[model samples]
Target: MIIKTLVHIPLYNKATTIVRTLNSVFDQNYKDFDILIINDGSTDESLELVKNINHHRIIIHSQENKGVSATRNNAILFARENNYKRIAFLDGDDFWCSNHLSTLCALFDKFPEAHIAATNYQLKRSRKTIDTVLSNFESTEDQLLKSFFHHNYLNSIFTCSTLMIKPEIVDKTGLFNESLTHFEDIDWFVRIGMKSKIAFSFRVTAVIDEIADNRSDQVEMKYRKLPDFTDYEAEAKNHLGLEKYIDLNRFAIALAYRMENDIRNTTLYQQKINLKNLSLKQQQLLKMSSLQLKSLKRTQKVLGNLGLHLRAGD
Candidate 1:
């Protein structure tokens, strides 16, 4: 499987870490790839810093201050035009272990039919560390539709930087949604994951530098996973117009409301039926909302007495 991959690094005000990030890519154990650096309207000397690296294989694309989604969209166009089979990404603030590419290559070799591969990485703060694990998945469209009922499997994987996907999948997934300011990855992943299997790399070959101000880190808190349901629920309801998706959205909103102690929103979301107008399952779902609401309150009271404060619903 001697295919070429394009590693797109989108840079903005990452002057402090851009060099290290690029160095890590050059240090990759597997070298059959081209590095494309998109200097997205950086006012700092980030571009100058990148030029000092002196790598011939690196191609630089400069644009005035486009957002990440746009930068990535351009990179995809470049990869497609150049005929790259695989596309891997590294944010300017993150760096990968030497074996990052080799590990993904090996996985793709093993699963010829797989369209995407992702690896587990260390989620790091200034000095502390949090470990997360993601596994490779092979799912059909039907299984994916069902999984959405329980949870969004792809989001647990975290960060687009960890994913290595085929170009065709990117094209099919329609690149990152330009309008979203956050959870863009989740939106794109759920769409693509519905069509292809996602595989995880068992090795921890990347370091996701979760700086204090980093968007995800700033929004972090203990017992925070529950609030995440709101974003997906909204995205599903508004962006994806499938009826099955509406059912799943109700279930998720119900969970988020339960977490935030909002019984009313919880019940309201739970009561919607999917009809000609709504489905029978949806009608049944509305009926059970009250029960779920009561149980949620009971659990919250126990937790509150035990000294846990619920953050307002996200």
Candidate 2:
């Protein structure tokens, strides 16, 4: 009666979307699985709604507000203790396509060497209504690690919702870094790609609802994880593509810091990036004050209104 898979869900104040997520899990074509829902101090009706479901296959764990990383680690720890062969992560606010587990599971069966697998996931932006592939995972680990190091806007692929990994891999690679409030998954993704074999599909099996909203100038940046790539820099010395990817990583970090109006840290990351990797305009934008950048964004929006769109990277 050993479950082959454990769907790890970290719940917060997601009463509205929790049911949708669980229903997707229930609708999966793959049935040899159990669910571990770790409610991370949700002050909403989320826990009660899940309690009412009364499904036998679901195991519930509730605790005070620990961030997503801690909750995810809890689920992995649970999976290890319960002897599950596979673990899939699904956030409270996200849901999966029915074939998600089946697709990932089949990858493991087909590629015995692959310790990690994921299906393509799409962004359902209510306003634009387009299916976008988040990550185009490469065939080789080197290619994957390179692609992973790049920002999501440019050929970004993996997501927690779409990913499935063998619990055994955690032993060699390690769990999510609890200290990182953001980019923890990417940090782990890099490590996984470096340490284990990863397999991915082009087929979409998860859906993330990105409610279209205005680009906030004053984006919050509390506890953002600054990924340390010092160790990888030596690896990049041999591969120029990897060198560009390292700069790209710095670019992404600088952008996040810029978004929070922290120019000092933004400059720190920007200083590490190769100026050639960025466009002339992007380079100039990086030097601008946050207020000036916000004004430029307003201008971009106005141009969009006139049917002239400008890419953020450009």
Candidate 3:
């Protein structure tokens, strides 16, 4: 039987949520898909749980702890060899809605020219759930690239879990950058946007759990490497003009430093850049002294205890 779509899931130590993630896939309305779960040396019960499932279409591959990028690349290679027509990604800890696959298939059928398609998603934060959709400014692929460069502080676009694309697009754009410990999805999306038209749907189709103690948070704490934006700077400038690229670079540098906990450098970069587009709290934080910033963090914790959460992204 011809596989219509190859669902690639990269599993780390996500035993707690792996079964729920798989259940979401198994419940999808679209049935012409095969599931590939790449176990990236998960020391937990993740692999055992995956094997306990009785689904014949599910295939689990085990390997030493290669990061997410390498695991995804392995799935891509498997899809290419097996002649899968389309590719979709779902991290083992996240899940999709019942109609997610059916909606994407319909979108591809509607827009034959679109090589990439993404659906909106819901973000499960600490206190409450928030729905996120692509901005109205991102109507076309070029516009999406522009919006992303200018205002992708939190990666508002559909993340890897909500994205589906044709295999030929992967052939043209290549695979995710293994060197990037973070922002690998953003880098891949930029490349894909440059090569083909990206289709967007406002329909919410996935749930992304963004709790504080996730694997990504742990990785960021242990391995602090700045994401390189130099590669896409020229392309961004060419597509969205020079000023926008400058703004994008400023934000990227500040974000990279912020991720590395270099508050001094983060504040310096934020100061040198424009602040009109940033949220009021973000601006205040950037201008605050180190001691003041620490006080604000304490205040944030207090607010959280009072059931009032303040997101930096606003």
Most TM-score-accurate candidate = 2
lDDT (10s digit) by residue, model 3, range 208-280: 7766334564443235343445555557545543334344445554644554567776766576565664545
lDDT digits (tens) for residues 119-211 of candidate 2:
766665436544553333445232223433432434446678888989889887899888766556656766775577777677888876544
What residue runs in model 2 are displaced by over 4 Å at the alpha carbon? 133-153, 212-219, 223-225, 238-241, 296-314
What is candidate 1's lDDT per residue for 250-306, written digit by digit as tens? 454454455455676666656652434334443443445445646646432322222
Report lDDT (Cα) of residue 231, candidate 2.
60
Highest lDDT model number:
2
The ten-residue window of minimal lDDT in model 2 covers 305-314
Ranking by lDDT: 2, 3, 1
Error of 3 at 128 (Å): 1.7
What residue pairs clash in candidate 2, if any at all?
134-156, 134-157, 135-156, 135-157
Query: lDDT (0-100) at residue 249 of candidate 1?
Result: 39
Scored by CA lDDT, what does every candidate get? 0.62, 0.70, 0.68
lDDT head-to-head 1 vs 3, winner: 3
Q: Listing every candidate in turn, what is its Cα RMSD in Å to the true structure after a full C-alpha superposition?
A: 9.0, 5.4, 5.1
